[model samples]
Target: MSSPSSTPAAPAVDRLRSWLQGRDLAVFHSVANRHWPGADPLLPQLSRSANHGLLWVGAAAGIAAFGSSARSRRAALRGVASLAVASAAINTVGKSAVRRRRPRVDLVPVVRRLKRQPVTTSFPSGHAASAAAFATGVALESGGWGAVVAPVAAAVAASRVYTGVHYPSDVLAGAALGIGAAFALRGIVPTRGQLPAPGRPPGEAPALPGGEGLVVVVNRASGTAPATASLVREALPLADVVEVAPGGLATALTDAAGRGRALGVCGGDGTVNLAASAAATHGVPLAVFPGGTFNHFAYDLGIETVQETAAALTAGDAIRVDLGRFRPGPNGEDGADGYFLNAFSLGVYPDLVRTREHWSSRIGGWPAGVLAAFHVLRGQRPLEAELQGRRRPLWLLFVGNGLFQRVGPAPGRRHNLADGLLDVRVVHGGRTPALRLLAAAVAGPLTRSPAHAAVRRRRVRIAGLAPGTPYAYDGEVAHSGEELTIDKLPEALTVYCPMPL
Candidate 1:
């Protein structure tokens, strides 16, 4: 005897399923028979191009190549990643879970039907899923790019039904799954827009309409400088832009800061560091343009493009951020100093930077970094430094201007640029430098492991350095004295940034 619960629901469920299938077939037939003007030749080729995600791949490559900004690269990467997830899901589970057959194409026009039909079960259309995933992912990162891709994605989904390879229900289900995949990926690795703006206090600065009072100093040697500088000119036509050659950054920045209502800088972290120092000393608001291979300071500030910074400048949106300093220099309290806008590090990092800089112009930045890492890890010895009153052997000592948080595996950003704390991280002395560094990277910020430890402090002092021991700060390597102190200047620098929505 069948239980009441099981017997009653089985027939009802079967009836609903039959009803849905009939409706699905009706829609599929309607789409197949309908005449779509100009869709016959265009859609079939578009559908064919999207086979195995080749079209999306090509689109992503194009976006990355032409977009020429960090946001574009990120959008392309996110789109591809979302596509991968959606494709895997459709192949592994979605297709097999519901074995719905493809629709009959007799009603479909001969020219509209695909030459080669899909053979897989069609409960969820993989093409629709991939298209939705890629477009949704791109949109999540960049609205403009997403707007451009969404129509193509919708057309691809429509083509599945127009060609009679998938029912409307199949396409709908697949697109839903694809969108879900994009959101899931966003949850795993959030888009920059999702992150909160740096919790920094706002500062007062002049609203430069068309950047009338802003003076921008461009580092000619920095990555994409010419292109970005040209963008700056186009974006802020009234602003005075000074392009400085190598070894003349100090004079140019000093002069720019002294004269302008606000000082703007375009370059890498190292160049930004000099600008930040000049701005702070001259008591002027600073604007940053990301014209570098790695614009760590600018990206952390959420100023990814010249347009963003220009917008901030036009509106006078500014905030106070902490400045990192190491003491005992040519002049100042505690004997003058040098400043680092991003981080200060000792041990293998300095050597790696030196080596990478040496070879970067020759072999390219990424490969040079890899080669530097290999050379430094293989040849460099652990640093012997006195920290917190005790002498110890260490592989690295990193001190950041503020507390840095782990985005995924390594420390990627800081949420509070004005926080009066130094993020101090260290990897203990070890035999295999590569393993220790890798372990530290995997360990992440504020987490301690057997190989590495991280802590936050108002001040950090390291001693017992050998004469002319190389240390790196903000991608610039230099020699240091026997003892060095790292500290923060709370809200000492004012920088322009777009206010978070």
Candidate 2:
């Protein structure tokens, strides 16, 4: 009997590694021995600190610590998220599927070696992956902020090769993986700041009588309103633009709604809430021009600047949206009728919002929120209230207008504008309040095993509460006596925006 011999398959990965060594080793060696010495001795030390993307973590933390604008702060948070995705891909999948040896330190100068080299497979550089991921994530939010980090990220990725730990091919693979992770995240998460989504066309919009028939109520007390008011006037020359002080904003919005063919307003979420309520009540379309701090509603509408909203108004791009309505007390007469275009929060949340506002301007929103959480938690006692017919000890409760997607332990943004439901999240602190709250804060609002519960419903009622209990909606706090009934008002308001309602 003659036996046939079959040829074994060649190791393509090994072959590629050899070719990369031949092509890239000389440059890597040159950089290590000669080029890197001219750089600060701290270069490799800095690279070592970047192990597991800790350096990127610190950088994003710093941005969140110092950045005041919601855009920059969100970019920082997204950067950390991207790093998580990229690193998980690299360590758990990318590296495991294709194992490759690290460059031999025999050729690397002692000065260029990492203090503590990675022990994992070196097929793709994890540091490079993290750097690219973080930078791309930031870029996806604000190009200006992304531009600031690009050079640092490029340097960090290059340092992996310069420190004689990875091949150029490894860095290339890592960067590609990182960029892919960022794009993948874009699909998974709800976001604004991307190219504005086209909403309902002009033909779908309700009629606007004329320039005089349209009225815009601008809150002069808003930090950015004075400047924004000029632009609104310039854009809609014949539209009646009224400058109202903050104290009288609600009444002014109601008055403007009564007279105008279409209602427009400028301010923060609180002011917008007033306008949205009026617009919804009067059954008129709303033209929202962002002219306040952290324009949550405007951002959700995909209207970043005043000019964009004004342009949309002129072009007649608009959509119908949801409004969260609640009777703050048993009857409308007992308390002011309440409505929110964003969210409503009770218990420790209102305190945190107020506390965060005190310091968020100086240190930035994320850091301030963190600081405020700690402060609020220390002073906070559970609010005993009836939730959906059950009596429970609740640390905090949030109800959003539409179905909101969770980011960490809280709702970040809504997936739909008029889903005819309220997104309800309740936090239960249990016996160890701090530990439970912190865990719940990070584990995510919708996780199955979470200390909190997230659900969607058309209505919720709370009874047996103390008189004039304070709650927050649209970033402003108010008192509601005894019982409250929160309900979803689907497509209750028409909003002019770039995004679909």
Please name the candidate that would achieve the greatest lDDT relative to the true structure.
1
| lDDT of each candidate versus the true structure | 0.89, 0.77
How many steric overlaps does candidate 2 have?
A: 1
Looking at candidate 2, what is the lDDT of residue 344?
92
- The whole-model C-alpha lDDT of candidate 2 against the native structure comes to 0.77
List per-candidate RMSD values in Å: 3.2, 5.4
Model 2, range 1-501, lDDT digits (tens) per residue? 533543243467678867877877676666667664455476676677787678888888777655535677778988889989998988789988888888887667777777677787888888888989999998888787899889888888888887788877789899999999988887776345443443332325543423446799999976467788888888778789999998999899999999877889987788898898888888778889887777877876667776777666665667877778888654434556678988898888888889988986687555787899889888568888999789888887888887665544554556567778887878775666677666655655455444677777788888888887789998888876789989866677887765353
The alpha-carbon deviation from the true structure for residue 118 of candidate 2, after best TM-score superposition, in angstroms, is 9.1
User: Which candidate should be chosen as best, given TM-score against the real structure?
Assistant: 1
Which residues of candidate 2, in runs, are more than 4 Å off? 1-20, 26-71, 85-126, 141-148, 159-166, 180-245, 251-261, 281-283, 291-293, 328-336, 386-393, 407-409, 424-430, 433-459, 488-490, 499-501
Error of 2 at 311 (Å): 3.4
